[model samples]
Target: MENSSRDYSHINGWGIDADPKNDPTYPMKKRTNEEHRGYSWQRPTQQAETVEVLHSNERPNLTAVFGTTVPPSGLSGMLRRYAFKHTENEYAHWLPLLLADRINVVEGIIEDFKNGKVPNIFAEKGMKADLQHDRAGLIKKAVIGGLLIGGVVAFMAGKNSNKSRKLDY
Candidate 1:
């Protein structure tokens, strides 16, 4: 390999930290004897597995701490189990998890209704905050959503009409 005489020291801010005095963080960057102290503490005892905890297939065991509240259940739970079967690198693992989250939201709303509680969706969705802070952005999103829904309805109506006309012939 041929060595070229290309000097990068002339560039602005180049080797700025080469001199400890010129370093902005020199004061806070002090190395104490305590800095060499390694992690000597023992790992905490693993939490008891009380619920259906879904973990990545790559992991040998569950973490020391795990959330017990809202254990996996219903259709979303099944989806989560399926996702855990596959490696995290695959889209098969993530797509079902994403779908499961959407299903879980619907399930939550249904569950709320079943419990004689009418959820305040407007407040839950933070629409009031959006109206106050981002009125224009909120309006734009509403318009786009309305248009998309209208277009789908129009297309379905047109397709149904065409099918009915074909039956007449």
Candidate 2:
């Protein structure tokens, strides 16, 4: 062992294994012919691209393992496709992807209703858990949501009233 100018003796367990005889793996320090070799087996076969797999613009080819469950199809899918056109580094790529995710949630809810299944949005959103653990946060969100909806309704009503007045003139 070479002596260093900077002392590491302050550190706990420092130089504990300075003596090779004290080393745990010293007994099993046998070198093998294949010890320095890379992976022995070839890469597992790449999953077949049966569905429309959205890949980053940077990647030349699809990855070995890629998801195929949900292929792009609807409006959200179109936004996602547009998003993928731009580089991942730009907001143009990310913002549309974020918007698409929100849109997909709404789409899912609509699809549930269309299938005659009334989705339990509260349970699905973990509101019960929020109520138990984060009551204040849940209340704050509800208040803000109510205020936003109220403001929109009021604005629409005012716009309708203004149109009605214009018709009377």
Candidate 3:
């Protein structure tokens, strides 16, 4: 496991090993001739030492970034309570603004139509689309293709059979 906390800039070749498959330990220490300066992580380290270092008592959400807090839960609490919360006691402070925007849009559209800015969508020069799909024709084509494929398979199977045909008088 990777210790997602500390900056490993001080440690060189932090989590590398000759054979990662053999050594299933985190921060796989590279054996170097460097003298240990009384550092726990220094010199050729053990798997137990790596495990101990990785597993720290530091709380993840001690500073509100690791998503371990209660109340509103996770980042949602940060947004709703701290960052983007309405100052007022109302449930939805943006409701009025949202409704206003919708009304303004509708009014703008109506105004444009009155001033002849918004042209008729059903105009003679307007581009038309084939909305009426031929569902029956599509189904018929699919059935025909399936039948043809099935017939070919059936014919091949019958033709390749080693059984002798008996002629009835």
Candidate 4:
């Protein structure tokens, strides 16, 4: 067979030295990206069509590339954790300790509440002091409101009393 490289002219610095027809690597129908000299930058037809077909048929044989029947895609960590909690697993030894953590938190809260005091190191203040502070604020507001209403009423009564003392002149 004649060398296909010598048969065709390399146009405009585009064609490569290797030719698919006579080259062993081409093997008749295998896809190769050898550049042709005649291919114009403004209008690329053959290579572009080859690329489009390849892209369209990219997912035809997933197992061919991945070497597995099923792909490796899966849910994220949060969804996995949620699903893991609902399903019973014989291999998960840490699940029991994680569940017990919630109970321990509740027990700590109950211990603090039953003793009528919050567990604190700095200042041991009773819970009633908080209630007393709230009550004091309420009483202060009531006293201020009464003083304001009394001042308005006393001013109005004085004005009416002065009007009564005036004779028609």
lDDT of each: 0.92, 0.92, 0.47, 0.48
Q: Between which residue pairs do clashes occur in model 4?
A: 14-36, 14-37, 15-36, 15-37
The lowest-lDDT stretch of 10 consecutive residues in candidate 1 is 31-40
Give the RMSD in angstroms, all C-alphas superposed, for model 4: 28.7
User: Please, what is the TM-score per model?
Assistant: 0.69, 0.76, 0.21, 0.22
lDDT of 2 at 73: 71
Error of 3 at 12 (Å): 15
lDDT of 1 at 49: 96
Over 1-169, each residue of candidate 1 has an lDDT whose tens digit, in order, gives 9988787888998878989999987876785655478647888899999888889999999999989898888999999999999999999999999999999999999999999999998899899999999999889989999999999999999999999999998
Model 3 poorest 10 in a row by lDDT: 48-57
Residue-pair clashes, model 2: 0
Measure candidate 3: CA RMSD.
26.4
lDDT, model 2, position 127: 99
* Residue 146 in model 1: lDDT: 100
What tens digits encode model 3's per-residue C-alpha lDDT throughout 1-169? Answer: 7857777657887755656665765343454623354446444333232111111123331321222222333233233433223434454534543554555555656767989897453343232322235556656766898999999999888866634343322
Over 3-82, each residue of candidate 2 has an lDDT whose tens digit, in order, gives: 77898999999999998889997665554645567438777799999999999999998989999988887899999999
Better of 3 and 4 by TM-score: 4
TM-score computed on alpha carbons, candidate 3: 0.21
Instruction: List model 4 lDDT by residue over 85-167, tens digit each.
Output: 44244334245436545555556567688989676622343435545667776567668989999999999999998888895
Q: Please give the lDDT score for candidate 1.
A: 0.92
The model with the greatest TM-score is: 2
Q: Candidate 2 vs. truth: CA RMSD?
A: 4.9
